[model samples]
Target: ATTATGGTVPLTDALELAQQGLPWLMVFDHAGVPLHLGRTKRLATPAQRLALIAALRGCSRPGCDAPASLCAVHHVRDWNTHGDTDIENLTLACDRCHAMVHDGPGGWKTVTLDQDSQFPGRTGWIAPPHIDPTATPRVNHRHHTSELLATTLARIHEQRNQEREQRQRWLSSHTRHTHAA
Candidate 1:
C-alpha cells in the first residue's frame, strides 16, 4: 500500500483496524485506487477529538499556542476535494491561523509529518516546493509536555476515585454493624 507521503508500505487488515475505526464518518474507493485522500461524511469522533487535542495540543502551526479548546478542527486536505474528517487528516487551528491557511499571504499547505513513537498525530505545515526554497519540516511542541502531565493526572484521579469508593463501602458496612448492636 501507499501512504499519503507517496511511500510504498505493506498494510495489513490488523494494522488498519488498529489504526482507524468507522463510527461517524468513512470513505471507500471501490476502484482499487487510493490516489486521492479519503473523505468523511461527518465531523471527527469524540475520541478522535480528544486524541487530536492531546496530540496536536493546539494549533498545528509552528509557534502558535492557541489551545485546542479555542481552535477549530481543520481538514489538512481540502474538505471539498476528497478530504476525510478523520483524526489522521484533521488538525487544530485557531481563528487566525485557520484563515491564514485558507487565505494566507504566500499560500501555505498543512501536512502531517511522520512522528516518532514518542508523539502520535503531530501536525505540521509546509510550503509548496516552488514556494519554499529548501522545504524544511517544522514540528509543533504545544501539547508534548502538557499531554504527559495530563496522563499522570488522569491516573491519579482514577486511583483516588477507586479508593474513595472502597472507603465508602467499608464505612457503610461498619455503620450497619454498629446500629445492629
Candidate 2:
C-alpha cells in the first residue's frame, strides 16, 4: 500500500490512515511497475444505501419530491470517466433528475459542496452552452431540506417499526399454528 506521499506501508496501516480521513490511492504493482489504473467497479452496498437514505432522507435534487425508496443511486462522475463507485460519489436522484444528469436540456455537472442553500452537501450545476444561458443555475434540494429531513426521519422510523411489528406478529402466529398441529 502507498500513501499519497509515495511512501509504502502495510495494507492495514493504509486502511487505518484512510479511516482517519487521509485519502489514499490504490495501486497494483508488478515487479515494481504500476499495473492498475485509477478506476474501480464500486457500488454503494445495501447497508450504505440504507444509511444514505436515512441521512439525506430522499432525492438530492433541490425541488424533487420523490421519496428515497423511489430514487435511484447516482454516481457523481461517470464510471466510464474513471469515477469511483463509493458513497462519496453517490447520491439518490429521481428518474427525471437522473435523466437530466445523463441526457438533458443543458449539460449538468455534479458537485460536492462545502455548504449549499439546503444543506452543506452534494449538488449539481449547469455547465456552459446550456439551453438557457441567461437563467441562473439552480441546485436541487429534495434531500437536503432540513425541514423535510426531520419528517423523513420520522417516516423512516415509523416504517421500520411497523415492519418489525408485522414480522413479529407473523412469527408468533406461525409458532402458535405449529404447536397446535
Candidate 3:
C-alpha cells in the first residue's frame, strides 16, 4: 500500500496508523492506486464517498459504531457476483464488518432495503440462520437516534389507527343490525 504522499507502507501498518487518527493517509485500492478518479466503474469516486458519508453516519452493520471516516465503501451485492459499482449498490462498512460479509453459512448478508422498509434505500444486514431463525434483516440505528424514534413512533401510530378503524367498522355494523331489528 502507499500513503497519499507516495510513501509505500504495508497494508496492516496503514490500518494501524489510520486507527491511531493519522490524518494524512489516503486509502488505496487493491492495485495500490489512490481512489480519487471522478469517473471509475471499479472504485468509488470522491463525490460518491462524500454522498455515502452524508447518508450513513457509520458502518451499516448492526452493533457497530465505527464512523464513516473509518469505513470502506462496500458493495451490498458482491462485486464478483456481477454487481455494479452504482451508488445504490454501495454502503459504508468498517474493515471488520466488511470482512464479516460473505456467502458462507456464518457470514452476514447485506441487502438494499426498498421504500416499504423501515429504513428505505439503506443497507440491511441479515444474520445467519443459526443466529436468527427467520433470517430477519436489521439496520444499524446507533448513529441515527432520530430515525429509530421516528420508525418506532410510526409503527405505534399505524397500529393504533388500524385498531381504531376496525372498532369503528364493528360499531357501525352493530348499529345497523340493531336498527334493522
Candidate 4:
C-alpha cells in the first residue's frame, strides 16, 4: 500500500517489521506528544465529524444545487479569530459560492435561514437591486409587431432539437459497440 506521502511498501514487509518488535514512536502534530504505533485518536470526535458531513450534504449557499462531495468546508466564524472547531461554526459551500462569499465588489449577501427572518424574500437566488423602479408604466412586448424575431426564435429551437437527436444517435451507436466488444 502507498502512504499518503506517496511512498509504497508491501504489506508483508510492514508486518515483518512490526513483528521484529522494535521500539516505535508516533508523534501528533508539532507537539512532542508520543504514542504507541497502533494508538491514535481522531482530530474531531465522531459526532463532530458527522455534523460536518450533514452540513455538507446540501450546499451552504442559498439556492445552490451542488452536492456534498463537490463542496468545501467553511468556517462561519473566521478560524483565525479563535473560532471553535464545533459544528455550529462550520458550513459547506461550492467553490463558486465560497468565492462569492469572500468577494467584495459583487459579493454575496449572506443571511441566516433561521426562523426569525427570511432572506431574498421571494427570489432566493437573485442579484441585489441597484436601481429604483421607474414611476412610468412598463411597456408590454406582445403589442409590438416583430415577425422577424418570432421566426428567428423558432429556427433556433428547431436547430437545438436536431442537435439533440444527433447526440442521442451517437450515444446509441457507442453503447452497441461497447456491448459487442
- Which candidate tops TM-score? 3
TM-score, candidate 1, is 0.48
Query: Candidates' TM-scores?
Result: 0.48, 0.46, 0.64, 0.37
Worst 10 residues of 2 by lDDT: 30-39
lDDT per model vs. reference:
0.62, 0.60, 0.76, 0.47
Candidate 4 lDDT tens digits, 30-137: 111222234244546444433443323445554566665666676655577675666556666668877765435554543323433321111122233342122111
Q: For residues 1-181, what per-residue lDDT tens digits would candidate 2 score against the true structure?
A: 5332223479888667767864323443322223432234443376446445544456676677777777787887776887777766777777877777754456555665555444345545454454546534455554344456666998999999999999999999999999999
Q: After superposition, how far is residue 3 of candidate 3 from its true place, in Å?
A: 23
lDDT of 3 by residue, 73-153 (tens): 999989999887888899899999999898876999999989898667889999888888798889888766767777789
Ranking, TM-score, top scorer first: 3, 1, 2, 4
- Over the full model, what C-alpha lDDT does candidate 2 score relative to the true structure? 0.60
lDDT of 4: 0.47
Ten contiguous residues minimizing lDDT sum, candidate 1: 25-34
TM-score of 3: 0.64
By lDDT: ranked, best first: 3, 1, 2, 4
